[model samples]
Structures are given as structure tokens and as C-alpha cells.
Target: MRSWAEAERAEVGRARLRVSVLVALAIALMIAFVGGIAYVVMVHAQETQVSRELRYNARYGVPGIAPRCAWVFVLEDGTLHEGDLEVPRGFPLRDDIDAVHASRGSIERDVKANGTEYMVLTAPGADGTTVQAVFDLRYQLLDRAHLLLALAIALVAGLLLAALVGLTISRRTVGPWAEALARQRRFVTDASHELRTPIARAHLRAQVLAAGLPADQRTDLDALARSIRGLADVVDDLLASAQLQERRDRVPVDLTDVAEAAVVGETERATERRITVLLDHPGRPVLVGGIETGLRRAADELLANALRHTPEGGRISVSVRTVAGQAELVVADNGDGFHPAEAERLFERSHRGPGEGRFGLGLALVREIVTGHGGTVEAVGRPGAGARFTLRLPLAEAGLPVGGEHMTGACP
Candidate 1:
């Protein structure tokens, strides 16, 4: 648990970091998009210019006087005349020349040879022959390569510069949020802590009175005691929710370990009610980045909720594993299932269902904690069926080395 002052610092630090990262990402994406467009336009223009040069050399140039980096060949009267220059090994594409001569149609294609690309065109000549033109594309290819390298360098520099700019901007942009969080969190934590003792005392006194009263007269007193205890639980949950923003001591924790621990904690309760508690976890760790205490609370809340709703002798299943790159913990119970419509509403603060002796704060607190760890929680259930609660957290970079502690039991 973090003190109010430490929580304030963590919240402010996170706010600034979030703003800085978002700004840097935005600028980096913009740079990449603009660079891509420029690269595309340059490539298109170069291709068009190369095609024009090939056409021009094919039409006007003689065999020996072809343009630089270009060769011209003429086939006339079934005799081939090559340029005086040393022809490339694959010159005068014979197939294209024969095809053009026979069909009297133009054939244009790109060919790669000699470690470079060539733009080749064989067309019917006005002088009763076939003319072939080849243009070496090495220089153009080199230019494009250079452009790509330049863009890569620019992108890297832009990212660094954007990060620096973001850092400078975030200090000012996150000021209001920092102050607001400090003020609000300080009050919530303080008030919740202050009220907890008195509430606990009142609850204890009511319980004693209800225990001593005659059975018929003690009904309302027991209800009052229960309500007071519920109030204490709410206050405790609020305190936990307020403290969840602390980013300190966030380490890679085994989600399987957390889930198993939660299940073990509820085992006594389950057995007392003749309910069976089953835990199924992987042999290896399902690691997630989070404050272990908060993550444990989230797991515990789900299991406790399942136990509370499940009827005596009913079963509860707790599972932890890696799913879709996330560490997932699921708690399911075959007890008093809720209506499907209330699945979403169950997490709303203060929303109470019929016969539910809670203020709907536990699941909400669990959601808040999981969300703070960059995770998600969901509820699924149907009337007369069972309810399932799943919690998912982004997996950490493989788990840190921790002593092996595991539990596994299949649920019937």
C-alpha cells in the first residue's frame, strides 16, 4: 500500500509519461506517413522518366550511337545488327524480338541481369524491321536506395526530437491533472480511513446486540449489523481503489500464483459451505506486469464473488493461463446466476441486485485495479445458469525468476 503522498507522486509521474509517449507516437507516425508518400511519388516519377527515355532511344537512335546506359538493336531482313558497344550477356531478347517481328506488335518488359535491372522494349520498326531498346537502371535503383536510407535516418532523428519536445510539453500540460488527482485522492483515502474505525465499532456493537436479542426481536438488529459491515467493506474497497494508481513496485508477477493464492484463501469458506473449490493453472508461469497486491485483490474479488453467489455444495472453478498474449484469470461458479442483462450492470458502483447484500462495489473495484494495470475484466452469466468473471492483463516480457509454487486440480 502507498501512502497518500507517494500515490500523488505516482499519479503525476504517470500522467506526464502518458502525455509524452502519446505526443512522440503521434509525431513519429506523421513523419512515417509523409515519408512514405514522398518515396512513392519519387518512384513513380522515376519509372515514367525511364520509360520515356527508352521510347526515345528506340525511335531515333542508331545501333552504335545509342544514348548512355542504353543499347539499340535492329533486326532487318532476318539479319540482326547489334550496337558497336559491348552488349550485355543477355542482349537482344531473342524471344521478344521474334515475337515483335512475327506479330508486328510492341513488347515491353523489365529484366534483371548482371546484378541490376533493365527496361527492355522490342517494337515494330517503320523501316521493315524490329527494334529493341534496353536501358540500364542501376543509377535509378541506387538513387532510390539512397532516398530510403535518408528517410530512415530522418525518421530516427524525428523520433528523438519529438520525444524531447514531448518531454518539454508534458510538464506544462499535465500540471492541472496532477494537482486534481492529488487533491481528490488525498481526500478519498483520508476520509475512508477515518470512517473505517467508527464503522467497525458500530458493526461490532450491532452484532453483539443482535446476538443477545430474542430471535424474533433480533431480525432487524442483525440486518442493521449486516448493513454496517457492508459499509465497512465499501470503505475498505474505496481505499483500495484510491491506492490503485500507485505505480511503485510494479514487477512481473505470476498470474497463476496470484489466482491460486486467492483460491486457497477461499478454500475454508468454500468447505464450510460444503462447496468445492477447484483450481486449474498451468505448469509454467503466466506473467503479467502489475502491483502484486492489486492484482491479488482483483483475483480474490472474483473468487469471493463466485463463492458468495454459489449455492451450498455447488462448485467454483478458478483458472489462470496465457490467452491471446494476455495473462487470463477466470472464476466461475454454478450458484445463483444473474440475468444476462445484469452482467454489465454488476460492475456499476452502488448498483445492487435483488437479494445481493452488497453495494456492487467489489467488482467495480476489481475492474478499477485491473484497468490501472492496463488490463480488462468481464462478466458473463445467464438466469438459472452460472456466472463467469474473467480478468486479463498484458503479459510481461516473459516472467522473472521466481520459486516454483503451483496448484492444480480439475473441476468436475
Candidate 2:
């Protein structure tokens, strides 16, 4: 399973891909729209030029012009007079001439004769005669075909170039996000390492001083020691959360033993607070595959969180069992419970609820450890009622049993 950071990077890549595709589509549509307008303008211009040349030939006949426009003159009595211009064979026949003469006003029309296209124009001559002129449209049609072909090639080339440029821009745009994430991870790792040394030295010095103190001073020294321990625990949690991405070593672990050992370790703290800590289990081994140290730390954090919240005389319970091919650990505490609205945010880093003397790192560490093991952790609670944290991890294969004795260890 990919880590959350890796999954986020993948999602960014997908978003970049979507942006590139949209950009390419926009470029393609723009080219098509512009190309269509240019095509229409060019066709209209060609038609207008053809009509102008036909009208000119009708009024003042050109003799033997290139590709020859045919001309005819009709008197008021409807007598036909063919002009000096030579009409092509099977073109501008008598019926075409009559249609042109019968037109009421100056107008242009297209006619096809013997597989050839012609643009015809009709107008009244200065001498009370009707004039008609026809020009061949083959060359104009061929030019339009070439223009369309050129536009198509341009459209394809433009689309490909747009796609290439879009891909490059997308990569450049997402690069900063990747760099920022890398820097954040590095800072967390370096800062956590730097903090561990001083905390360890302070904890050591406190232990020594507490050992030498007298009975009356011993309580104050012990309290100081506990405070130092809590600080160390925070440092450890920060280090573990930072290093989770780097730790992938897995082994078969007995969760039942881990839960029992975590309970034993917190027994002193619970007793001091007058809270009842109960370990409920069938004593049967529950096997899971994960990092044993990380799993133990997760269990410890859960237990610590429960102990910290439970009031004096309140009950805390820890249990481990296997259900539906998964190993489950449940930690419940009867204390001033949290609001249901805040339950989901309880495991977020550095988020504190309505409580005093809370560092807010315990539940976050537990969430990180369990998630690193390809497991899930959830909290459920109602105000003034109680809170339950449940963790579910995939069980190891039945034949790959790890002994509980090997899994027994003190929580960090």
C-alpha cells in the first residue's frame, strides 16, 4: 500500500494530466473555430470576385479573354445577338439565355452543364437590350479544396503542438508542490532528531537527582521526573511520526501479548490517578504482521490516552481479539467524553480538545503507527458519555504463528 504522501503526489499528477487535456482541447476548438471563419470569408470573397468579373463582361464584352466568359444580348423584341466572346460548347444554351433574360433585376446564379460549373449574371444594357454573362467556376472550386486541405493540416499540427506545450507547463506548475512537500518532510525528520538528544540528557539528569533526594523532596523530584518523561514521550512521538515513511520492516507479532504488556506498563500511572485499568482478553494469541516496536508504541499511546482522560475512580479497559480475519484492539475509557463532532479530528496532529495538560500528540502517533501498518483506527464518543478507540489490523496467515513470548516487550 502506498503512503499518504505518495498517494497525494499521484493525485497531483492526475490533476496535471487533466489540466493538460483540457488545454489541448481548448486549443483544438479555437483552431477549428478560427479556421471555419477564414474558410467562409475566403469562399465569399471568391464568389464576389467571380460575380464582379461576370458583370464587367456583360456590360463591356471582352474578346477572347482567358477561360472565356460567354455573352449574349437580347433586344426589347426578344431577338438574340451573340457577342464576339466565344462560348464554350454545351454552355449557356438557349434556355439558359432565356432564363437570364426573364430575370426581373440584376442577379447572379450558378449553373452546371456537361460536368462544368458556371457563375451567370444578368443586367440591363444601356441600349434597351438584356445582357447575360457566364464564367467557369472550376478553378475557384479547386482553390477552395486546396484551402480546406491546408486548414486541416494546420489544425492537426496546432493541436499536437498545444498538447506538447501543455504537458511541459503542467510539469513546471506542479514542481513547486513536490519540492515543498519534500522540504516539509526533511524539516520534520531533522527537527525531531535534533530534539531527542537534549530531552534524553534532561531525562537522565532528572533520574539521577530523583535517586539522591530525601523523602519530603522525593515527591517533588518524582513529579519533575514525570514531567521530563512526558516531554520525552512527546519527542518520541514526533520522531516516530516523522520516521514512519522510512520504516517498512515487518514481522509476525502477537497482539495479545503487546496489549497485556502495554496495560502492565501503564498500571503505575493509573494507580497514581486512582483510575481502574482493566485488561480483558481470552489470553489466546492474536497474530498480526507489522513492525513490533511500532505496534507496541501504538498500543501504549492508546492506553496512555485512556488513562489521561479517565477521571478518578473511572474505569479504563484494553482488549485484544481476532475477528473476521483481522486483529482488533479496543481501548475504552469512562471519563469526561468528547463531542462526537470532534471525534474525527482527535487523531489529527497537534489538535487539542477541551482538556488541560494535553500535548495532543498521543492519538496522532497512534493513528500514524496503525496506518503505517496498513490498518485503521477510529474514535467514537459522546459528550459526558465515554470514548472508545478501536484499531483493526490484518491477521497473519494461520500457519505463520509468532510466539507471544517473543512479542513481549516494554512500551516506549
Candidate 3:
């Protein structure tokens, strides 16, 4: 049994380790790639410099061509004499050489003689004439070695900085999610406790009503029944919302059919209120991927909310239309609209305005349903002006006829 925090940290650590290893490998490869190229280029440049120096020296010998010079040995054959010139200190000189010979052509090679190394360039001058130029690359080698070391240091520093930045970003990003999870757990606990109380009270009230009381108990029983219903409705809404949030996949829904069903249900309930229902765009079905029950619930909540707020005889209009690959469900009424102060918090769970026994969960449920369907619900109404609730759903498929006869019916 691993603690949640420990498990999360371990997971994060593993992820960070994986990312760091990949980044380190990439950085190492990059450095090696660049360093290998630089080494090759530097070696080539040093060789070029040595060749250029040799050419300059070959043109002018001794002190004028080179600052340091030395004579090592002499050789003779027949009527000519030849000698070897030692390279200056810190300059490359032939360390491996065969016996100096007087011949028609010249030979050049890097040789070690007497434990000293040299780069010797030899060529024929005239008939039986030979010359050699020697140079050392100790200083060039040391400079290249230092440069490679510096580049490696810089590369390591850059990799460390990148790792630090990555770690910081991961921590910052996951912090909010951790806090939200904790809050959600608390909310669930609180909601469960709240649910238990109402249910228990409703059960007690039901038992009392079932005990066969007198007429005096009728009013109390009715109030208890209303409370029980309200509690049940809230519980049902909470469960539905949770299910919607947890939905992993979506399916296409016919908006026109869903709208007709919602309107019909609201109409039945609004019979006592005498709210007029106006249905527009009665010929076409607009299809989109959304939960039918959620959509219908949202629509009903909007219509019922309107009827509740609107005065009797006030015109309540419901319209559905398809436009530009989207379906719009608009519900409006001719009554004083929402107050400015409540506009921002209208869709927040359990927030209500100035009204008796008004639990502010209806609009919140509406918002949840619309959001779960991958759509947007907006309220555009000002104080003293009739409010409009607009639901937008994406239309299904391409070039579908907006006037298909599949959509037909008024709210029940």
C-alpha cells in the first residue's frame, strides 16, 4: 500500500528521470557531434598552417625562413655531400629517418630519431639536389585540447540548466492539479454528508405519514413530501452531473428531437402557469454528439427558469435553428431579466438570488449539461429586459439539408 503522494512523486520522478536521460543523451550527442567536427577542422587547419610555414621556409632558409635552426648530420656519396637539419625547439623535426642519402629524388616523412619527432617535407631541387622542411605541432595540440575541454564544460552546464528548468515547470504545472484533487475529495465528503441528512429526514417523515394520522397531519405531510422531492431531485442532479463529467466517449444526438421532447415536458409542467410556448424551425433535425438526457435537462431547466421568473401571459419563445454547422437553441421570455450582481455567479452550484425557497442549482445543472455535451450555454439579458438562454451544439456531417422533414412536433 503506497501513499498517494509518494506514488505521485515516484511517478513524477520516473518521468523526470526519463526526460533527463533523453535530454542528456541528446546533449551528449550534440556536444560530441560538434566537438568531433571542431577537432577535424582544427586538425586540418593546423596541417594547413604547417604546410604554409613549410612552403615559406623552403623559399628562404635558416634564420630568415625560421627563427630556430640546427645542423645534425652529414652524408656523402660519390662526389656530393648531404646533411640533415634539426628542427627548432617546439617545432616538428624528423625523429625517424634512414641514413641521409645523396640521390636524384627526395623523400619526406614524419620520423623519430634519437627520441625526437618531426614533420619533414623533402623535395628535389636540381640534379642530385634535395631539401627538407620540418615543423612541430605541440602548441597547436595543446590549444585544441584546452578548447575541447572548455566546450565540454559549457555543454554540461547547459544540460544542468535545462534539467533544472524542466523540473521547475513540472512542479508548477502539477501543483494546481494536486490542489484541485484535494478540494474535490473534500467536496465529495461534504456532499455525501448533506445527502444523508435529507434522506434520513425524508424517511422519518414518510414513516410518520404512513402511521395513519388525522387530517391535521395532511399539511405537514404535504410539506414533507415537497421537501423529500426536492432532496431527491438534488441527489439525482448531483449523480447525473457526476456521470456526465466522467463520460469518456461521446455519441451523436439529434438536437431537434431532443428539443421537442424537452419543450413538451416543460409545457406539461407549465400548464398551471399558463406560459405560452412558441416553437420555431419545426421541420429539420440538427444532429450533434451530446447526451440526450443532459441536453433535455438543460433545455427544460432554462424554460422552467424562464417560466418561474416570467409573469403570467408573458410570451415565452423557444426556437431552434441550424446555422453554419451549428444548432442554436434559444429560450427567451418577456419578463424582468437577471440582476447584474447575479450574472457572474448564476451558473455556480448552489448559488441563488432573492427568492423564497429557491435553491440555486437549476442554472448550474444547465451549465453542466451543456458543457458535458461539448457545447456552450450563454445568457444575454440585462435588468428590466427579458433574458435569453442560448445553447449552441455542433451540427453533424457536411452539407446536410437544414430543412429535412425529420424534425416535427411541439412540446408535450
Candidate 4:
């Protein structure tokens, strides 16, 4: 239970972190996009306004009477005339003014000097002479810089806010899911616990009645006993499955040993049913990392499933080996098999095949256990051809002798 709680907490923590990161990224991107558009628009408008001011000063204005951040100079009759205005470092742009006067066309260009940008325009002035205008762009550059700084600060704050919001949302969303899971597990556990004693008593009664009945009339009583026993087994399986994920004592387990034990456990029943049970393995230990009891139960379920399905005198093989850094435990039976398409759905909980004759909790629990251990289980078979279940787990150690020793024997 402590382990289950820890695992659930870890799962929720990871989900919340993931949500926070995604939300932060989304908000950051949006802020960046909007800030970029605004910056672009501001710069464009500033440029258009600056150009308009320069043109207007050039067209009709004296040098000292130019608008704010603007300076003008007139070149008429090869003489410069500017009404005592403070000129910038590179004044008048004499080359451009002369070029415009000679070419009789306007010359416009941008220059950067004196720690600021300047836009200059030289065109026809009064009396067909030349006029030069220069606009200072220091205030515009400062405004852009301030905007960028503010956007940076806003982005940082927005990311923090977004992360907080994401965490809150994730907590609220996942809280109910985790609670529902806890409730379901508790219900299964409580239900299974409550049902165990009655099933056991019913099984005991059925067995007693079977024993007391006459040999000729014992057939139905024996069937009833078997049915009750099956019910008890199902209940036990449910309980085990409910408690599977709560187990945290994962250790190195030998797959070969597990297989052999499962086959031995069913030896008596297989012998009684007149089924040929084959136990095949590498003889040596194939190590995997998992809770030993859960793995043992999985192996037992597989072998028992095969044994139960195989007809009298039929064959059931329990094989364990190592392949490609993985331990493969396969159980195959030559008995009443299922359709090829039903292979995947066979592992779903309480999924019964045609006429309600199929595995319920056994295969499903096997899947849950194997998946919890970061392994895989596969099923494949053709109807009337028998079924095969392959459970694979990663090897606890590399180079653990693949197929070093092969042994095959039939269990009595």
C-alpha cells in the first residue's frame, strides 16, 4: 500500500510537471509572437513618421524654423544659407546637395552618427535650388529599446504565471482520476475479501457432498464441486491482481525455476486429467527483474490455462529460454484453441469467448503483472489448433548464457 501510494504520487507529479511545461511554452510563444508584431508595427510607424517630417522640412521650411528633431539647409546660387541652426556632426551633406543640384533630382538616404540615427533628404528648394533636411532618431530608438525590455520582463512573468496555472489545473484534473482508481481498488479488495470465505465454505460443502454421494450419482456433485472450486480460484485471482501493483519488492527471479515450479504444481491435476505436460527450459536460471510472487503467479496462470484447455492425453509445453537480452516464457497447448483475431482481446478483463468459455481474470492479471514489470505478453493461435502465450521480460543481467543448456522432460 505504501508502494502504491508512492507510485501514484510519482505518476501525478510527472503529469503535473508535463502540463506546466507545455503551458509555459504555449504562453511564451504567444507572448513572443504578439510582442514581435507590436515591435514591428511601432518601428514601421516611426519610420514613416520620420520620413514624412524630413520631406516636409525639405519642401517648405527654413533651416532654423524646422520642426522638432529636424534641421534644414538650403543651397541656392552655389551658396549655403541656414538661419543659425545648430547643425549635426555631419551637416548639410554637401555631396548629396551638390549631387541633387547637378542631377536636378532628389537624393535621400539614412546615416548613423553622433550616437543616433539620421534621415537626410536633398531636393529642389526655393528658386530651383536645393534643400537638405536631417531628422534625429534618438527618441525612437530609445522607445524601441524600452519596449523590448518591457517585453522581456513580461515574458518572464507570464511564464511563471502559466506554470502555476498549469499546476493547479493538473492537480484538479488528475485528483479525481486518482481517487476513482483508489476507490476501485478498494472495492475490488473489499469485495474479494468479503467473498473469499463464502466461496471457500461452498467449495468445502460441495466436496463433502461429492464424497458422500453414491458412485453412480457422484458425477453431478463432482461437477458442482469443480464449479465451486473454480469460483474460489477466480476470487483469489481477483484479490491477487488487485494487490499486484502495490507490491514493491522487485528482485531478480529465475524464469526457468518459475516455469519448473508451475509445471510441478499442476503435475497432479495434469496426471489426473490424463494430459501430457512437457517442461522444457535451458535448465539454468534465466534471470529477470520482477516481484517473484507475481511472476510465479503469472507462470502458474499460463501453464494452468494450457493444462485446463488441453484434452485428455493432449500435450502442454511450458518452455523458458533467453533470447536477445530477454527472458521468454512460452506456454503452448494442443487443445481447443481460439480464433486468430481474438488474440489481443483475450487479455481484457472479464472477456469471455463464445458461450462464455474463456479465461477471465487469469490472462488479464498476467498482462497487468507483466506490463507493470515493463515487459510484454503476446497470444496467438488458430481455432482447433491450440493456443500459445509468450511472456517476455528483460534480462536482469546481460550475457546470461543464451541457450547454454537445453533440457526437456515430461512431468508425471
Could you tally the backbone clashes for each prediction?
0, 0, 13, 0
Worst 10 residues of 2 by lDDT: 403-412
Best model per lDDT: 1
Write one digit per residue (lDDT tens) for candidate 1, span 341-379.
888888889877787687778888888788878888999
What overall lDDT goes with each candidate model?
0.82, 0.74, 0.62, 0.81
Better of 2 and 3 by TM-score: 2
TM-score, model 2 to reference: 0.56
Question: How well does each candidate superpose onto the true structure, as a TM-score?
Answer: 0.56, 0.56, 0.43, 0.66
- Which candidate number has the best TM-score? 4
* Candidate with better TM-score, 1 vs 4: 4
lDDT of 4 by residue, 213-237 (tens): 8899997787777556545655555
Off by over 4 Å in 1: 1-18, 168-173, 189-338, 350-412
lDDT for each residue of candidate 2 in 1-412, tens digit (9 for 90 to 100): 3443565567778978887888899888998999899889989998889877887777786334434445544434577665456667754455655655676466667888756688877666665666667788878888888988998998899889988988988888877876787677668768877877777777678778888878778876676765666556555545554553643335688888889878877877889899888888777878788766667778988888787778888999998888787899999999878899898898888888665667888888788778877899999998778899999999876565453322111112
